[model samples]
Every structure is written in C-alpha cells, then in structure tokens.
Target: MLLGEELRLIAYNTAIKHNITTSMVHKGLYQLGVSGCPWKDADIVEALGDLGDYGVHNLFAVERIARISEVHPYSRVKGLLYHSYESLGVKERDENGEFIAPKLLWKENFFNRNERGEGNAP
Candidate 1:
C-alpha cells in the first residue's frame, strides 16, 4: 500500500502536469481504489461518467475518470471542463455556485427534461 504522502504527491504531480488538482486526483484514486494503474484518455473519459458534454458531478463519474487516466504516466482528465460549460443551461449558479440543470430542455420537452418524466422528482 502507498503512503498518504506518496498518494498526495502522485495526485499533485498528475494535477500539475494535467492542470487539475491534488484533491481531484486524490478523490479519483480513493474512489477507484486504483494505484500504479494503467488507463488511457478514453478510459478516463468513460470513467468520468460519459457525461456527454455535461459537467454533472458524481462519485462514480470522477472515479471512472481517475481509473481511465491511470494508463499514462501523466494523464489529464480532459473535456470535463468543457462539459461543465456546455452542461450549463438556464440555471446559472445557486448560492453555492452549483450549476443546476434546467427543468425544461426546450420548453416543449418539459415532459422529458432530464430523461425523467414530469412526475419524476428525487
């Protein structure tokens, strides 16, 4: 098992090279339970939840991202930032700066806004 400091270093280094953050990397590692792994960019993208240009955040999403990037000695989780921007719809930012998906996809498609029926509510 790697020490916490070692994990931190690896995450920090990866973040610096890939323009991410130690916290993000650490979260990925912790989520995936992968160390000294070998994943690729595609893997990272898929691992990141295949969010389809949406900045939706989830534990599984980030975990998959971390696993996928492990293939390369220096891998970066790309496109998520882009997804974050593209996913932003009507809702700007809540008091906590969280981007909330709009209830209506196109006003008329309110019945199927987020693949969820109008009656759907979590």
Candidate 2:
C-alpha cells in the first residue's frame, strides 16, 4: 500500500530496461480475467514477465488462501496462483522466439481424483 511513485518509477524503468511495456501492465486490483490454467510452455523468467504485466511485484509472495481468495474466487490458493499467471495479456510474438506475454510454467495435477468425476456420498 505504500508503493510511492518513486518505486513505481523504478518499477517502470526496470520494466523498460527489461523491455516490458505500459499497456501490457494489468491493474489486477479488479481481478479481471483471473481464471484459467497456468501456462505450460515457458520458463519461470517468462512467467515472471507475464506476472509483471499484471502489476504483480514478481517477488513471489505466496499469500494465504483466505487472502488470495479475496482477490481471486478460487477454491485453492494454488488454483488461484495458476489462474493469475495464466491471465496475462498476450501480443504478437517478436523475432526472439519469446512471446510478449509468455505462457506460464507448471505441472498438471492429473492424480487429483476430485476432478475426475468422483463423489464421496453413497
């Protein structure tokens, strides 16, 4: 809450130094498009770029479920994190084999029986 303009300016300059743009930044205070799968094709750095575009500090702060759920309407914090990284704005690919808003990087939970159409009630 204390992110002064100086820090914002530093962040902006860092973004520019790293080649991030303005329109690409998302004001996630509104939590729009905060749903979907974390990308599976890019590395952590690329994923951080995408998160940066969303106005996240890239400090990798893993908030509690209650806190994150306040921002994202998801059941699990992990799910919300996945969705957050997956919702970045994408643009046409540049000539460096890197996507403007690169995809996320994570593993799929194929063994989660809950999502496999199973129930506990008899």
Candidate 3:
C-alpha cells in the first residue's frame, strides 16, 4: 500500500495536471468502489476519473456522479453541472463563494462565462 504522502504526491500531480484536487481523485475512487470496481484496478479507475479536460469535481445530474462515474463524451456530461449544483441547493455562489457555475444550461457556456470572469469581464 502507498503511504499517505506518496498518494498525496500522486494526487498533487493529478491536480496540477488536470486542474482538479486530490479530494476529487478520492471522489473517483469512491465512485469506482461504489460501482464495484476491482481492488487491483483501483489505481486505473482513479486516474480515469481524474483524466479529462474538465476532469471530475464531485458533480453530475440525471445520473450518478461521484461515488459513480458518468460515462463521459459530452452528451453524458453536457448541461449536467448546473443541475448538479442545483441539486445541492445553489444557483451560483451563495454569498461565500461556493457553487460558482451561475445556473448556465450548458457546460461549455459555463466554462466560457468562467473564462470571462462570469460577466466581471470589462
């Protein structure tokens, strides 16, 4: 078994390379476990969950997300973040800076808004 520090390093690299966090990696692991992924394939499963332009972030709607994989390819993940955030009872940040997606309908639009500072662009 890998030490916590070693696993942390792996997670750190994953975060840096994928723009996600170690905790998110854990989410993937959680999904894999809940899905009955084999113990020997845990590492692969974790990496798969963390591998993507958007990677994983503990969200998905109309389907199982974390603690469960969404089987990507846009059509599966598209427009899901909004509902994911919604399911958590947020329309965007709630005065403290949580749930920053801003209720957009599509994932690309959300990312576009995010790139433009969510209309803070000037």
Candidate 4:
C-alpha cells in the first residue's frame, strides 16, 4: 500500500506531465483506487459530477471519466462525457448508426479546442 505522501507525489507528477491541475490528478488517482486508496466509487462519481460539463473536457479528467465507465456501465458519467468516450477508445455511433472514429472526434474536440484554449474552463 502506498502512503498518502507517495500518492500525492504521483498525482503531482501526473498533473505536471499532463498539464492538468493537481486536484484533477488527485481525484483521478482516487477514482482509479491506486494503492488501495480509500475513496469509494460513490466518492468518485460525486467528484466527477462536481466537475460539470467543462471540467470534464480536461485531458487528465478523461482518465477518471473512462474509469467510471469501466466500473459503472450505466453511469450518468458516460452520458455526460459522451465525446470523451470516443477519445478513450470507447465505441460511439452517429444518429445514422455509422461508426464515428474516436481519433477524429478527439482531434476535433480536444486537440483543436486545446490549441484555442477553449478547453481550459475555469
């Protein structure tokens, strides 16, 4: 089991490398249950819920979103972060039932918006 300080360091490093907030990294680790972390699934769900629409768009935030989908398939998190699902390799279909490639959607929504600083919502 990892110590709290160790976990904090991991979160900090991940935040620095990913260009995301430390809080987001900490929350993601808690959600992922790194080293037997005590945070429950409900806690993770609530944390993600508090992030709102724009917060969910952050690059690091996608990890937590994907974790939620893996643990809870019927979760509202999936619907909330629908666009992110594609980026995380989750399959998505258009209204016409045609496959929508995650790479294209990721480039258009994440990378492009990131270049414009539109994804950096406060």
Candidate 5:
C-alpha cells in the first residue's frame, strides 16, 4: 500500500486556494490520524479554523487512537478507556474560542475501563 504522502500525490485536486488547501484535504484523508507522519495540532486548528462552531470530537478520537497505536504493539486499540476530557485535562477549544484538539495521553489509565468510565482518552 502507498504511504500517506504517496496517496496524497495521487489524490484528486480541485486546486482551490484557501486555508483549506488541497494539501490539508490530503492530509485529512491520509495522515490525520495514523502512523504516517508527524501532524501537529496547530495545523488542524489552521485548516479547521473556519469551523469554529463545529464540534471536533471525531478528529481528536482518531488522533488519540493513533498516538496510542504508535506505542502499543497494535495499530488499532482493541479495548476501551474510561478517561474523560476533564480527567485528561483536554479542553476542545482554544482561548480565542477557536476549536483546539485534545491530544492523547500515554497512560495505562487511558486504556483501562474504570468504574467511572465514559469514553476514549482523547
């Protein structure tokens, strides 16, 4: 299989100009949440800045799962975690009221199902 970069090169391009550039679209598709390359939260913030009112819960989920997968023996975590956004200290927005992403914590507690369980760590 081609890597994210490779797939990106072959992806269809409308060549529209904006912060939501073709590159961002490609990255969103192939590299956003996986063991492809280093993707920063700032980039997500930039590409999705216009989507301020939009809830970014799904994107963070992929990011955290990928981070955990990178450390663990598998690429897909098979278990559930109990950590909440509050417990992980993840605020889903920046001070400017723009949408910020919650990153993954590399804690065993992130993967274990606690009595107060809610959802994934990110």
Candidate 6:
C-alpha cells in the first residue's frame, strides 16, 4: 500500500479504537510538526507519542503499530523534509532550527479520501 494510505489507515484505526475524531490524531500529528508528506517511521512514532503524552493511549493495537512501523522505517525523511522547507526560507522554526508546531486546524474531510478520489484500493 502507499504510505499515505497506510498512514490514513493507522490514523483511522487509532481514532476508532480511542473513540476520538480523526482530527484529534491530525492535531497530534500537527503538534509533532508533521506536514503530511514524506512521512517516516519516526514521524509516526512521534505522532503516536504526542497522542500518548496528551493521555491518548490504546489508540491502536500493539500488533498494528508494529506492522506500520515495520513498513515505514525511520530514515532521513525528516531531515530531507526539513531541508526542503529550509531551502524555501520559511521561518517556521525557532532560533535552534527546530520546527515549531503550527496551530491546530481541524479538517474533518481529510479522512474522507475515497470520496475525494485520493484513496488507494484496498
């Protein structure tokens, strides 16, 4: 499956298991500086950690998390994304060059990729 599809599945399953909205998962991801592109395993891990830090536990089964993690291994994606963002000279960072999380903007339709013709075949 495509990475985006995998991510959406993880997010959807996580939200369903936690009885929370998909926006909640997106909020957590946003807080972790995820920009919905070039995802890495670390991004997923950090996003999950952000949710856990906010007391959102048991979002998904351990087996599911493990499977996703195995599929998306931690690599240079974060650095690559950061580099691309930096090349644009965007000032979305602190003095330390660390990215600053953007404000939460919930877009409920983000989870409805199928209706939008952006979904992958199952």
Predicted model with the maximum TM-score: 3
* Candidate with more favorable, higher lDDT: 1 or 6: 6
- lDDT per model, in order? 0.42, 0.33, 0.44, 0.48, 0.39, 0.44
TM-scores of all candidate predictions against the true structure? 0.32, 0.23, 0.36, 0.33, 0.24, 0.30
How displaced is residue 44 in candidate 5, in Å? 18
Candidate structures ordered by lDDT, highest first: 4, 3, 6, 1, 5, 2
- Give stretches of model 6 more than 4 Å off: 34-122
lDDT tens digits, residues 1-122, model 4? 46678656655554454445667655554434432323454444344444433455344454545444453443444345535555645555668989653221233444566679776322
Off by over 4 Å in 1: 34-122
**Which candidate comes out best when scored by lDDT?**
4
Report how far residue 88 has shifted in candidate 3, in Å. 32
Model 4 alpha-carbon miss at residue 105, Å: 25
- 4 against 5, candidate with superior lDDT: 4
- Write candidate 3's Cα lDDT for 1-122 as tens digits: 46667766776676677656667665554444434443323353334444433443554411233222222333343334334544543343547866443221344554566697873221
Mark the 10 consecutive residues where model 6 has the least summed lDDT: 61-70
Residue range with the least summed lDDT across 10 consecutive positions in model 1: 101-110
The Cα RMSD of model 5 versus the native structure comes to: 14.4
**Candidate 2, overall lDDT?**
0.33
Q: Could you list the CA RMSD of all candidates, in the order they appear?
A: 13.9, 15.7, 14.7, 12.8, 14.4, 11.4
* Candidate 5 lDDT over residue span 1-122, tens digit each: 45555544433232232324454444443444333434343333233322222333334434653443343322222322224434444454568988654344333544463334844543
lDDT string, candidate 2, 1-122, tens digits: 22446435544554575444433322221112122222221222233344454444422321211133333333233323434333522223457966444222222332243357542211
- Lowest lDDT 10-mer window, candidate 5? 73-82
Error of 6 at 27 (Å): 2.3
Judged by lDDT against the true structure, how good is candidate 3?
0.44
Error in Å for residue 2 of model 4 = 2.9
